[model samples]
Target chain A: MSAERLLWYTAVMAGVTYLIRVLPLVLFRREIKSPFVKSFLYYIPYAVLGAMTIPAVFSATRSLVSACVGLAVAVIMAWHRKGLLPVAIAACAAVFVTEWLMRML
Target chain B: MNAAERRQAFKTGFFDGLPIGLGYISVSFTFGMMAVEKGMPAWAAILISFTNLTSAGQFAGLDVIAASGSMIEMALVQLVINLRYALMSLSWSQRLGPEFNLIKRMIIAYADTDEVFAVSSARAVGGKRLRFIYMVGLMIMPVIGWTGGTVIGALASAILPDAVRSALGLAIYGMFIAIIVPPARDHRSVAVVVLSAVAASCLFHFAPVLKRLSTGFVIIICGIGASALGAWLFPVPEPDCKPPDLEERSAHEC
Candidate 1:
């Protein structure tokens, strides 16, 4: 894209994202009383993060097998409640080792 | 409350946010490399990170820009992908102390990412209303780490070895897993929601027409659909006490 077009795209993206984030905080001045709404809100984080994760993880690396191995490592580490950095580094390292082995094969 | 208390809350929030900020660097570094590979200039990619601070939205926006998609398409895509933040913000609306004015609400809402929301809402602030101060502290490092990582990634993409970059790309997914798995393990309802979302996302990925749907729409469908299912299946028991006042709403319900 041209410089001007890129600028516009960035602005629009920023504006839309900001509006999505801020509008609810500004508008929902009253406490939400509904149990169903509360339950839905509670689930949003897990569902959104999980949906974003899978399948996408398989594509993050060059090789599918390596990515699978990396994801397994990540899931295992996270299941054990490892901190984010440790889990991230472990997963990355697993992919690195797996990718190297695959290359040799 | 007082100026001193506010300053302390900000400090504590800054510390709480440090690890998340570090995690963001690795993720945004991957984003920067991808953006440059897609023909965005380093400055443009950095600018996008600086303003947007959203990994999925910026990545999707770049795809739309590369495809020469229409402005409306870009807006719609962002709207769909970032819509979850609206839910998060609504949840947080009750968390902010009465001291949070309109200006502070707008400013802090700008930094309300998944990790920030999780961290800010989960912490027990001793029944106090210093959340706005804490949020300010939480947002500070992420803004820097995200934008800074982009600049480094765009500048260093050519120099970084492919093997290392590819491995680093998984860091963002790792972060997501780190965020979700612990919560899922604790809450059966959360696990069900996650499994449902994964199923929905997989169906969208494989089905012919659904596969053609934009990433944003797919996320919206899966997130809302799964959460709605979770709500139907597992409603929170009604609170025994009356709802707290606005100031006390920041108490530890979430």
Candidate 2:
């Protein structure tokens, strides 16, 4: 992409994103009182994060099998309430080792 | 807020945000590499990260840019993929204290990524409202880490071995899991909501018509659908008596 075109792309992307984020924060000044609305808002994080994580994680790595192994390790570590860095490191390590083994085979 | 309290909130938020910063580094690194691979200049990649902190939105935008898609297409894609942040920001609006003015709201809203929102909304900094100073503290490291990673990845994508880069890509997902798992384990409602989202995502990915939808639209549908279902199934009981702390609120609902 040309520099001008890239600049426009980035600018538009940034503007749209910023508008989405800021509009709600600025408009809704009062505490939300509706239970259903509150509950829906409460669940947004889990739903969005879950939707973003799955299937995508499987495709992030070079091999699906290694990705699965990495995911398993990540889930296990997370289940045990491990910190973020440790779980990430363990998952990365798992993928590394699994990929190495597969290559050897 | 008092000066001492403001300092404390900032300190606490900064510390809480450190891990998220680390996670952002790995994730944005992949983004930078992908941008360069698609023929974008290194500076443009960094500029993308600097200007737009969103992960999925940027990725989708990159695809559109590479296709030489129209500006309207790019705007629509970003709007859809990032619509969830609007919901998140709305939720956060209620959490902000009276102290948060328009300027502060706009500034803090800029850094309201998924992880940042998850951490900030879950934990009560001082009282009934989210501390503005604390949020500033939380944003500092992630911004640095994200921009720093993009610069490195864009400049050095060729030199980094595929093995290491691929492995590092897992960090973003790992961070997502880390954010959700604890709350899921603690609250049944959260767990069910997460499962519902996963199911909806799978349906969108595999089903015939739904599979044709863009990723941004699919995520929007899944996120809203699952959350609405969760809300219907498990509505918070009277809002008046609810605890200020979200973690406590979940436990109380249970």
Which prediction has the highest TM-score against the true structure?
2
True contacts kept of each: 0.80, 0.76
Kindly report which residue pairs in candidate 2 clash with one another: none
Per-residue lDDT tens digits of candidate 1, residues B1-254? 68987787888778667666766776788889899998889999999999999888998998998998888999998998888788788877866788778899899888988777766644532334336777888799889989988988899956667888678767767767776787677767778999999999999999888898777777778889999999899885556211123124335322
CA shift of A96, model 2, Å:
3.6
Question: What's model 2's lDDT at B142?
Answer: 87
Task: State the RMSD for candidate 2.
Answer: 3.6
Tens-place lDDT digits, model 2, residues B191-234 = 89999899889888888888888776777888899999988998
Tens-place lDDT digits, model 2, residues A2-48: 88998999999999999999999998887777788887877787898
Docking class of 2: medium
Candidate 1 to native Cα RMSD, angstroms: 4.6
DockQ of each: 0.58, 0.64
